[model samples]
Target: MLPQPSGPLRLAVGGLTSITDDFAFFTYNLCDYRRTGRSDEARYARVEEVIRELVRPGTPTVGAVQELPGDDWTSAAHGLGHLASATGLHCQAFTDGTRSAAAVPGGHDCLGLGLLWSAEVDPIADTLRYISGGPLWHALVMVDLNVGGHRISAASYHAPPKAGRDRRTAEAGLVATTLRSHAGDGGEIWLGADWNSPSSRTTDGLYYDPDPTEMVTSADRQRWGDDLPEIGYRTDRTPDMIMADAGFRDAAVEYGAPWAPTTGHGPNDRNGPRRIDRILYRPAAAAPGGVA
Candidate 1:
């Protein structure tokens, strides 16, 4: 069952990647992602700080959070409770990942995609589904919302990686089809995504490696075209292109790049950051509105 936080959500979309579901997966990435990632607790603290500072006090928020934990650990419910307690706004999380106990070391009991939203967001009942069919990597969460008194449908998506370009395109197409269905039923659409590929927002405009066989000669690379295309793609297109064709605005066109790299630093110089996380939407046809 998808979460339907009790209240109203405003018209805005936000997305962030790799936030561990609570600290449940902390032990899994203690050395590699915890300490080596950001000096111990600093990474977790930063995400909390972000929610506290950016989410604010009296407005609705729609966050498409990637790398969320499954319900077995109580990540989504508790995460929503935490946000509500901190900001005085209703919050909830929705994910399609199943609840399973931890099966491997350095892994969470459950891990997948989710939507973090304030009660005002109004998620449609049973609107959560796995993209690219059942049991895939990402989930799509939808809300049939009324913003500025206009009924609309909004969605949060997390697309697969660059190597799986064609599949990601198919997933984007699925999302597009869904959005079109909503529109045909008299609803407009908005989308937020951790698209995992380059756009006009990325440091590089193109998404595909241009040449996969030469990029990384692993046995998997050799198997893309001849074998499972799901593992990777021999050819690809930028997800932004697909979203644009779907009639959503690339937020990058308005927000520009973040002032600095989003990750990898030794106290100062940042690594090559990419603008893979983004918001896309078709503005309500009647009025030009701001992200409130």
Candidate 2:
């Protein structure tokens, strides 16, 4: 009998920043080298160019991306179609952007989430979840795939800004629950999100406080609700813990390597360079959805 294929899948997850709200505010900051993990002077003149590089050929890689811009449902679908053309990774459930855009808020001239997968990966199904009460509200994109001889469920999420950790925490919980319900018996689920939560380090290899309690404003308390874990009130609070409890491991923290800050202000800036994005996943297992 032929030996089974060996090796891990090459996956990339990131927040591309909003074309209208975020990127438009800072047009000159399109140094996409971080996402490509390469050093190139090429700027993000068009979203398709960046998408093209994120999942280049020769390697079986998939991308879970946030903030892929689409002005409406048709455009949203088109935006993903463009990525698929550039990377050769088919976009699941991609019809005209016309219909899917309406159910999701940002499709009308705003950023949206997406999944880009390699050819060997067969798309099983996909769905979306709209998150409210964050610093910014956006829909979450989830996709299930069978690749590398195993089933996988993947999702792309961008949480509210750091200004609202309480809300971010709640969003994390919802994401976790969704994964559990969909995970079924077993393959594995990797939920990648631009969590916007601070880590203990910065891109320049410097230490920083991970305290989530920097600004627990009165309004924040109301948003946090009365009952929550003690860590929820800590200065080091992050949505990772919630996902951890949901039974997933942060690939960055587990591997001890992280991509540079995809999009953020400088060290002195309020939204400084933080490796807040991550690939949260369950260990290899066998089950229905492969997400035990």
What shift in Å separates residue 13 of candidate 2 from its native position after superposition?
12
Per-residue lDDT tens digits of candidate 2, residues 62-140?
5666655534455556656655666566765423332232122242125565666667555663343344223345556
TM-score of model number 2 = 0.62
lDDT by residue for model 1 over 116-196, one digit each (tens)?
Answer: 444444444434433322433445655554333345565655565444445776677778787777654334565666665
Task: Report clashes for each candidate as comma-separated counts.
Answer: 3, 19
Error of 1 at 164 (Å): 3.8
Clashes in predicted model 1? 3
lDDT of 1 at 238: 49
* Model 1 ranges off by over 4 Å: 1-42, 71-89, 92-110, 119-135, 162-166, 183-186, 200-236, 254-271, 286-292
Question: lDDT of each structure?
Answer: 0.42, 0.48
Query: How high is the lDDT of residue 102 in model 2?
Result: 14
Off by over 4 Å in 2: 1-51, 54-56, 94-109, 125-136, 162-164, 199-236, 258-260, 264-270, 286-292
